[model samples]
Target: MSKMPTPPTLPTATVRPILDMNAYDGQVSAKADQGNDLLMRRTRNVGAASVLFYRDPIEMVSASGCWMTASDGTNYLDFYNNVPSVGHCHPQVVSAMADQAARLNINSRYLHQTTETYLDRLKATFPDHLENVVLTCSGSEANDLALRTAQRGTGARGIIVTECAYHGNTATVTDISPSAFKRGKLPDHVVSVPAPGKLAYGDDIAGGFADAIVKAIAVLSDRGHGIAALIVDSIFSSDGVFSNPRGFLRLAVAVVHRAGGVFIADEVQPGFGRTGDAFWGFLRHDVTPDIVSMGKPMGNGFPMAGIAVRPELLAAFCEDVGYFNTFAASPVAAATGLAVLDVIRDENLLANAMICGKYLREGLQHLADIDGRISDIRGAGLFLGVDLSPNGAPEDANGQLVGDVINAMRRHRVLIGAAGKYGETLKIRPPLCLRQSEVDFFIEALGKSLRECG
Candidate 1:
């Protein structure tokens, strides 16, 4: 037999990596020379596009519940992962995945009762109108398919998204994601609008967003590419976790419909009851979306994602081209999805998120009260953002402060990340199973890091 051909490799820096902190040219760590040597070997083998967290990236070996153990035998409280929504490596999810994989892990082509059961339970969590669902292997595929459906259904090519929004990584979806582009330029068919201002309106948050969409629609219509859909991350997560002014999304949804366009809710980040009050993030806004894309936490870190749509919207797309995925909605995926839902309800994770989230926010608020560098704190449930600044003024926009805090927290054995256009907002989204004690631990670490950075 002929030898298998080796895969071609792309040169370093050819593709800008995610969360690449190349500007920070510093030593990995003074404590662990062995770990730093391993990191050097990893960079050479894993290619330049592999992004790692912290100034001295950790080598995590395993995790369970709200804690992860690094290769250096350090236990770190995980407050940066949302994919393990129910908690990392929960017994229920692990058992389901293992049991199903051992039994039958076939494709969707086969008629399986497990898939039907999982779909039935999944559909029950959503509104009645969002009854049709098409499963995909990843959120990128779901968003890509949703985009195609919107354009075909509305007979238009124009799309509108938040100025710094990121939906996914597919080629087509990337055009609509201004945050993903290093140059920050969107395609002609796509229009970007500023995200809901943090202090825009305490009670009328929907008005500004609606007005922006109205203007975008008019401009796209004038340019001959009529509006197709307006998509947003329900929590406005990347735009700095703007979840205030409940039900503010109603006006935007209405405006999209008025302009003969669809509204798509990208719930890949905020779904699975992470936002505390509801099962889906879009529900908190008191609006119905034409289509909703989900992933990440759906299978509790498994590669399962899907788009739930109104039957009418799905019908139109099906008429043109039907969706099919070999590994999507497979036996193993169905089992994993079912297990996640079971754990969320039986373990009462939503209630835990609400209680612990409030506790965490109050703790953060206390820190903000004493420190001027803590500019603003906002968000819903476990998905919160803490804005950092040197002078504590709104105009500071010091990305370095946020970066320093991240590195400091990592050194303290607490994992976290940052968000927003300038990457100045600390993104605190731990596993939904976070407890009161864990919340206190994180707060202490954060306070210490804040002081050190100051």
Candidate 2:
């Protein structure tokens, strides 16, 4: 056999936990909003686990399209939420949920026409091979189920992921998500490779990424875990949005398959036309995932998620254990999900994402030309990552600079967030129904924010 490519030397930047990046630290920020009544109540309610955005979290009262109205009557252009993929408080989606709830809302165990219809519509979007769909209440549950299914199907405990990936919040999925860990290290059964980016792989991302996977497989086997699955968000959202040189994931996927492991595409971030290039992010890479886990935008914020798997794999897993969810595939969820799909089709949001994404990138490039601190811009469709540095050097990326810019953007009435290992990449994800005028507004706000931060 031909020798496998060697893994490349990676950067030494300290990886930031996904939740900690751009998050409000209660200890430090408490004094700023000390007299705020809502803040006091929230702190008392959720306490230490309350993760709010910004140094001063805005209290949102209402939202529509791509704008959110704060309690103080300030309307901010939303650029950080993907949960409302089609738009915020979409009338059709809300109406569907209400109508179904009024008529009938029952669990998946019951044979409901709306539930089956929604599943049929959803299944038509995937590859023909993924014939089985399992519904859940959240992306975390979907990922949890996917990992369990992969483990059962392959009889291996080992799993592989990108270094800064944020799969979900469940106990099982958290082990595989390096970005979710605030203190402890990943378990031995889980291994992570550097994300597919020029900083790590230089010119040959496909070869370098595949080589890393090979090394990870070797490490897992040596640890007596072997390989169960190689799962990832094809867009690599948390790893600074590495979505370029399409088909880069094909080789890495092949490596996993050769090692007798399944490939799970975590589409929680890049699914439902958010990437624009394809309906699902994996479709852009041209790789066949053994299982595709999705959520977040499934019901356009209605709390529904699921995994589409190969029939054989699902059957193999179900043979040993029974599975069911109390709220999954409910009539209300089905109606809401169906409406989301209809809105996507009717509004031509996919094309809108593609066109608006190009416009947004071009505007960002203009900003990059003027601002040396704008180190790099990466992403597809409405999801994007813009790196910030003290200078023009990407190796010297500055999370502090990003933090200042994010807060400044908020002051300019545009809300955004951070990503990447060092929290140096501005994670920009607006509603899919974004307009050109709104794009212009974001670009203007970003320019001003960069100037202020610089």
Candidate 3:
């Protein structure tokens, strides 16, 4: 990754789980006054699992570039969304999707030129060894397929994941996401390890991660579930955004390979040009994963995701079990994917991310220098985190500061989110096309929010 500016380190406190609306003390009726009745009716009709962000959810009507216009005509600077990697509703992507939909949208069974062209372009973004791809409509499905492929290819059932890691929402994937477990328990076939942290491991972060994976592999094998795959969110977004010491993932990947387990990189958040240095987050670590699952920004908010795998691994799985998705790899999805690539290259968003990200981080670091609560700030490119803690202790503050800061930012019309095991980190991942002026606005808003919250 590019050596962007980094704030000084402090002990990172585990953030709380995602916010629960029921537990929120904010006035629910307030939203109803602001025309949330329709939303509430839809919410009631929708599945109970469907959740909305903010105490008063954003009834977003339109978005452009890095700003979202809410129902009440309030424009919020988007700093928490990566779904629109190129930017919200890019003209090229919208036009491509519309044109492709008007022309033809068909399944992969029938040969399609757009599908072939899209896949070729996507595969070109990956390493030479990762030549095959299986398309899915969502990241959850892609991750599920990658997991199944791992077991089929390696003939092992065990999986290793970082504690508090969230790969996807599927049944099998939920088992590996330690935070998603109902009772803080894991399945027999899965094991959780601490993600690379500054406090627990001290200087040898990579060694610590490698050792944990090795131990997890042994434990899984001894427990009769032989190691099949060790998967991770390359950015460690859920585990408080640990993206320092580039190439740290190589050590753990080597251990996984030695143990006959595939290293699967869940690049849902860090893929595309968000990482600035490279197209994929795994490449930042200089490690080649056997299976790389990507989503979120693939089609620039067009519900497209897929897994790129080594031909040998995918070939063996396909030989025994064929795969197909009804809406995946459709012509419309191909056009959207192609358009996303075009925007990234044509607009030079990667370089923008690098420059803007450095400016943002430096501004954040200046804030940290002035405020003790802004304990640690780390990550690369446009995806970054600001770890907040009380007295700089890891065990303090359940999300009071973070929640205050986030809500305060909302009041300031700058959108951002919280993450980590106490929700103490501000997860600032704006669209890759964010400019220097917008970065300055975000920094100014963040500073004011911090001061007001304090």
Candidate 4:
């Protein structure tokens, strides 16, 4: 008897392992670790330890052409890469990134036209009111500036935010985020109200929005608190307020204005072309936000962010105090952002999202009929969700069924995500460049996973 002969060692960079498993797409088989001993060692204690890691945890080594390839050599059709709004490693974006890095990767202090060009491109996308932009390194930072600008412009100390909505982890935003505020007790300046949920609010979406905004303003004002801003995610991405009937936000915006509070639209999650029909989710509301904060898809995963405030607010902020960020308007980031805009327009991804998103929703509804456990299926455009509960509107999953379903999907090689306070809803936020075929694949995987979970 003899031990099997060892294969000749391949270089660390070139070694590709044939994994014993499949990715979301089986045709693109994936392996956990090929030639890297370190990865295998790390996975022993830390990898494959969670429900989300049911499949072989192959580290993705390369990505391109709307798909990602893992170390095990499996290819995944990336429907959930919103951060890469344009696409995975799009050639245009890659070339721009390389070109900018080689030429001028400097900061804003050096009076460069790159920043102006980038800002102009962004401004052109929004309505006329949101004319001024101040660049930031992230959504959280942009929100921070937005808050400061609003406070300065309106001379208000009170802020209103939606329930369960996440507006970055910054101290200011955390205070306003009721769901996030429980950490150290909510900040005194922050007030919150229920986010209109799909099942709870139904078609008459205006029932609570305006009243809630007005009430929050009154509560703070009664204590001699000035109204600073009514900051909210254009569509509450985390809290499940995908869209209230047309006039919900419009009415809320009016109330905030009447109360002398600024309306800040946090577009971190729903900005760019993710919502499909519109460039920005706030556009769906019909009322213009005094300050619009954008991120996530701005640089297509390059970590660019900004505050597009009303010109008046900009002037007030300028008069109030100086504002600057070290990496704000960095040339490379601006170039990447510019390239993203060009690619989004050239590829007509927004129209694609609109059409594909509707089809996906209809497919999910059909799936719900097949699976009673599916409590609710709601969303706008590419930002969608499938609620797992007996009642279609459970804020939280009563049992482990929803969690189990998500885990099962991963096992089947589909990498969809989950959300809701109890992780009950299966959240589907695929990249904007996603096509109908990919969604069909996801829906099929999802249907099978749901049946298996039960």
Candidate number with greatest lDDT: 2
Which stretches in model 4 have alpha-carbon errors above 4 Å?
Answer: 1-58, 198-203, 390-396
Residue 237 in candidate 2 has what lDDT? Answer: 93
Q: What RMSD does each model have against the real structure?
A: 9.4, 5.6, 4.1, 11.0
* Rank list by TM-score: 2, 3, 1, 4
Give the per-residue lDDT of model 3 (tens digit) for 1-454: 2222333454444434554411233255454545657665656677465567776667889999999999899999999989999999999999999998998988878888888998999999998999898999999999999999999999999999988788888998888887665455898999999879876588899999899998999999899999999999999988879997999989999999998999999999999989798888999999979999999999989999999999888888889987999999999999999999989999998898889989999999888877777778899999998887755555453566787788888899999887777777788899998988999999899889977965
- Give the 10-residue window scoring lowest on summed lDDT in candidate 1: 9-18
Query: What TM-score does candidate 1 reach?
Result: 0.92
Q: How many pairs of residues collide in model 2?
A: 0
Q: Write the per-residue lDDT of candidate 2 for residues 1-454, one digit (tens) a residue.
A: 2222323333455667888888888788767767888898999999889999988888999999999999999999999999999999999999999999999988878899988999999999999999999999999999999999999999999999999999998899999889988899999999999999998999999999999999999999999999999999989999889998899999999999999999999999999999887999999999999999999999988999999999888998999995899999999999999999999999999999999999999999988888777879999999899997776678876578788999999999998989999998999999999999999999999989877865
Best by TM-score: 2
Candidate 1 per-residue C-alpha lDDT over 287-340 given as tens digits, one digit per residue, 9 for 90 to 100: 988899999999998999999998887888889888899999999999999999
Q: In candidate 4, residue 62 scores what lDDT?
A: 83
Give the lowest summed-lDDT range of ten residues in model 4: 14-23
Flag the better candidate by lDDT, 3 or 4. 3
Q: TM-score winner between 1 and 2, please give it.
A: 2
Clashes of each: 0, 0, 6, 8
Please, what are the lDDT tens digits per residue for candidate 4 over residues 311-408? 88899788868788888788898889999999889988889889988999999888766666676777788888667664333543443455577667
